[model samples]
Target chain A: MRTEGATVAFLDIEKVVFTYPGRAPVVDGVDWRMQAGEFHCLLGRSGCGKTTLLKLAAGLLKPQSGRIVLRGGELAAPGPQVGFMFQAPTLLDWLSALDNVLLPVSLQRRPTPQDAQRALRLLDQLGLASHAQHHPRQLSGGQQSRVALARALVLEPPLLLLDEPFAALDAITRAELQDDLLRTCRERGTTVLFVTHDINEAVYLGDRIALMHGGRIVENWTITLPAPRMQAMRHGPAFNDYCARVRAAMDGAGT
Target chain B: MNPTPMQARLLAAALFLVLLGLWELVVRQWGLSALVLPAPSAVAQALWSGLASGYFWPHVRATLQALFLGLAAGSIVGLLAGMALAESELLERVLKPYVVVSQVVPKLALAPLFVLWFGFGMLPTVLITALICFFPLMENTLTGLRQTDAQRLQLFRMLGATRLQTLLRLKLPMGLPPSLRGCAWPWCWRWSASSWPSSWVRAKAWAPWSSPPRA
Candidate 1:
């Protein structure tokens, strides 16, 4: 949370490049940055490397070239300062919901009563108070995703990297989760790098959308939509216009 | 219609009695020797005499001792070796061949070599039993650890979990059920091994005892 200067970016990715073994570069030399409390979405088609870029930002993967710095410090590996959400809920089935939420704290040492209390509070905040004692199989997919969201927020991490966390949910559930995510993240002022292929989702959730093509940022847009983004805004002309532009840009990039 | 629990129990008991009666009648009619096929009554008489004369106690003690001791030793060692093998790939690569060879050579063949080293007594037999129980548990533990969900592992990595923490909190707990199954499957093998050692020990001594089988 400490800042070296007023001009220092919260999260900075500088000319990072990565490739899997025996494959072409998935994330070809890319440079990007996010300011404190900014919501940025990386939008791309399948296999275009948006997820790989997010992983690089989270320090889950090392770049073949260049560097990534968080809070003006070089990112070497995954640390508690950043929270990550995978495409699937990825909850441990053997543990109860509350125990799973407290896993991050419990990993280093025994969870103090305060940690348990905090985890319970997070579950309650996510409307999962009653289901705190349930195992993953006992909960619905949407509920599981909510728990995963709470886990990502439990450390009160300054930066969050999410890889299409709601892609599997029904439309209504997805909308509700998006609202919950926006409200919680805005209140905490967490800088988020969300990866998704959905242009509408990017337009709806992000303050800025970065269109990625072939492992590079092809276009970037600053959403000027009114604050407290409402469900009604999705039908507005301004929202439709932004979605249309992003779609066209994606099409052009694909070609 | 399906029978109730009590009826099912009674039916099983009645069926057992009928089978026993048929066996007794066939043996008596054929004038078969007890050495070949003992009748139910002959078996009961021997059991009663063994208990009344107190001839069965030491044999029973020896057998029980071997059974419990072998299972305890084998299961514990197997579980630990499994944990070790699962934790380090280098350790697995360095030692896996020997582990496989130990299992590959039949225990029956190894019994004599154990006798040569430990002498004709309970120790060699227990060693063989322990060796018999080792492979399944180790294999199961390795499999369970390896089979952990990739996404969950990624989640752990993202949460800043150390290697030890991941093993204790995630891998070990996940591997336990399979490890227990390893214990269960070898139970029948344990019983056979219990009786097997005494005969195997006698055969090694070249002095076959004429005593009836101890139950």
Candidate 2:
């Protein structure tokens, strides 16, 4: 909600509303703004429009009533400046891990040799270089999701939209991914909008957390927990305080 | 039934012999003429004689040529039409009703009209073969394309892949092979097996009755 000065918003959703045919609005007139390099988590219950909001921000869905603007232009349709990672890895089964990472590059242009090298480097960063030639099915669940993240990062888009990307993973793998993402995005200075149902996950990873209920954001909090996002942060008093606040905000908020 | 490969083969052979024996008995007991319903032995003898004389080779070659050509041509039309329907909602809306209606009409009824328009040659028969084959290919291909992974499709769109790029990079790889199998393996087999006989290819042999088809 605060942009400080004359900085053009990296991403903006102004009174956006979306609904399925013959149904009530799934995403009501909700407005959100994210500055560059901010890692924001959208936390909510299962049917609380979190994924819909992420999709709207990613330019995969059109807001039925209002609009979403990205990088100073109306994001009427999906464009190259945004990256999306869904709940599943969605790696092409026919392509190798490295090839999966390079898919966006290959789709937009004839990827140069340098582009391929960059893809390999991304795989290396994700610790999947050894499995570059392996198909998606050969990789474990956490590994596949990491590959998905690598694919999303291939373009180094200014904004990344993730929809509960790690909820399916075991706890240890989830923590490692959270840490890796924390270091990687902050270093790259990428703005991120991550969706999740897990409260601790939000507290663990978000620089700011927005809690959505029914069709709108009911609460927003800037978490000042110490970073590097290690395991100790999960048990810290500040972390628990933020969690309790989020829980209290959820009580009888949406029907 | 419960056994090694060799035992399975022996069981198949035993069933074949018993089936032939029953056929032979039923024809003999009914006192049916050979022309109406030939016994298995009579049919085998005719096949042996036909082979010895090399009488059916040209017809066999003609049929195979029509079949493969029909398959290749039909596949192209079917896949392209299916891709169009999948990529554009407008095309799907415009074309799907006609496709469903075409399927409802018996394809054999169109063969005579084709013959009337093109004359009684290989073209008419080839056209009929293609017509018979394309429907299954189109239907199966449409199904495959419609069934592509929603997650992958969203990824393709969000990455700003062009429609052509999405078709080539995502849709074809995911849909083409399954659609090929759907039409080529089972659906086409059942439909073509039942349909091809009523088509023009069979007309030449049956001019009162051609020799039973070789395989």
Candidate 3:
């Protein structure tokens, strides 16, 4: 995504700390901020609390020690402005692909034809337009993940929180979806905070990358790559440089 | 010919006749009392006569009315109770023991008392049917509601789904297909009430044996 005004902060998570009772804190005291339309990736290994941090942002969990503010409003719960996608496809398997995308709206009222049209358009954008009526079991793993991505975006939330949503996919599908997600988010100017363990994904997708170690963001980088990251970008020097930086931070933290 | 449908049916009919013939021959050969051992043909003939005379319709209608009313009422109540228990831990803690206790005692043991209170007509029979249906319906529906995937529940929370919306959109749908396996059990009980010899067992308990006159 090309930069417009990068000055406006869309999400500010201040000194957040969270723990499951009687255990060590999963997310230690940490501060992070994001601008509108910026795609930031929180890269970390398993159990380092990246997902917990995303959940806190989504208002699915409350941080014990700090607060998360969106658009100057302190969030006590998940509002309409933020959309979340979990690692699992998390689509209601009983629902069709189209209906699953329409789920966010369906909970409010009977989804109007307009809502359905919007869902169909999103499926179309994700290349799942033709499989709208198919059940989740009928779709391939990659196809199901793409449908989930469509569902996450169907609400047109200004902020999207994705926690390793495509971790289970094959390489080719993951790359294709990463490109689709980047293009879509870039076009809509959606502020995204995506979480992942893969160095290559964080390097390829994020406008800025934050590496989490031991429950805190230990390293953060503003990627200066041009818009429309391509498949060939993986073999490029700049991409390798970003990956090395992320990997070095990972190894340096020894987490 | 590779067993055509019509031919298969014909074969079935022929076997049925042969079985009846053997039954009749065995009864005749043994000279058994008809009351003790009616032949298959005799039973079929009696059944046909009852149907031909329209003698069975009112009785059938009465039984069906009881079954449907019992099934519908019992199922609706069971679902509501199940939902209430599943949603509230307090309610589950308070009421689940009572449900378990009720289930532990023989429900059929109470059926006769219902007859005494409600009279011998449709009300008592309907109560029996409802009692037979209540347990499975409540248990399965509760299990289904409780078994909703945790991730899906998280999704509901993220979507800001209200309690009703979460129950309807997520829990209800997820619980259905699996709970349906056990949910079907009530229907079996309902049919057994109508078609099976269950009433015979009841009657044996409720009525005195026929041959006795004590001096």
**Residue B56 deviation, candidate 2, in Å?**
2.8
DockQ winner among the candidates?
2
TM-score of candidate 2 restricted to chain B? Answer: 0.73
Per-residue CA lDDT of candidate 2, range B1-215, in tens? 46999999999999999999999999999999998999998999999989889998898899999898888888889878877787788999988999889889888899889888999878888887887788888877788778888888888888887666666666666775733432333322223223345445545745745656566
| Cα lDDT, model 2, residue B98 | 92
Residue-level lDDT tens digits of model 1 in B57-131:
999998889878888898898888888988899999999999998787889898889999999999988888888
Q: Is the docking of candidate 3 incorrect, acceptable, medium or high quality?
A: acceptable
All candidates: DockQ: 0.25, 0.26, 0.24
Give the TM-score (vs. native) of candidate 3. 0.85
> What is the Cα-based lDDT of residue A40 in candidate 1?
95
Docking class of 2: acceptable
TM-score of chain A of each: 0.96, 0.95, 0.95
What is the Cα-based lDDT of residue A76 in candidate 1?
A: 88
DockQ of model 3, rounded to 2 decimals: 0.24
Q: Per-residue CA lDDT of candidate 2, range A183-249, in tens?
A: 8788789999999999889988898999999889989999998766778878878889999988888
Instruction: Determine which window of 10 residues in candidate 1 chain B has minimal summed lDDT.
Output: B185-194
How do all models score by TM-score?
A: 0.86, 0.79, 0.85
Candidate 1 runs further than 4 Å off = A1-6, B1-25, B178-215
Worst 10 residues of 2 chain B by lDDT: B185-194
Q: Candidate 1's residue-wise lDDT over A101-218, tens digit each?
A: 8877766455679888989998888899999999888999999999999888888899999999999999999999999999999989999999999999999999999999898888
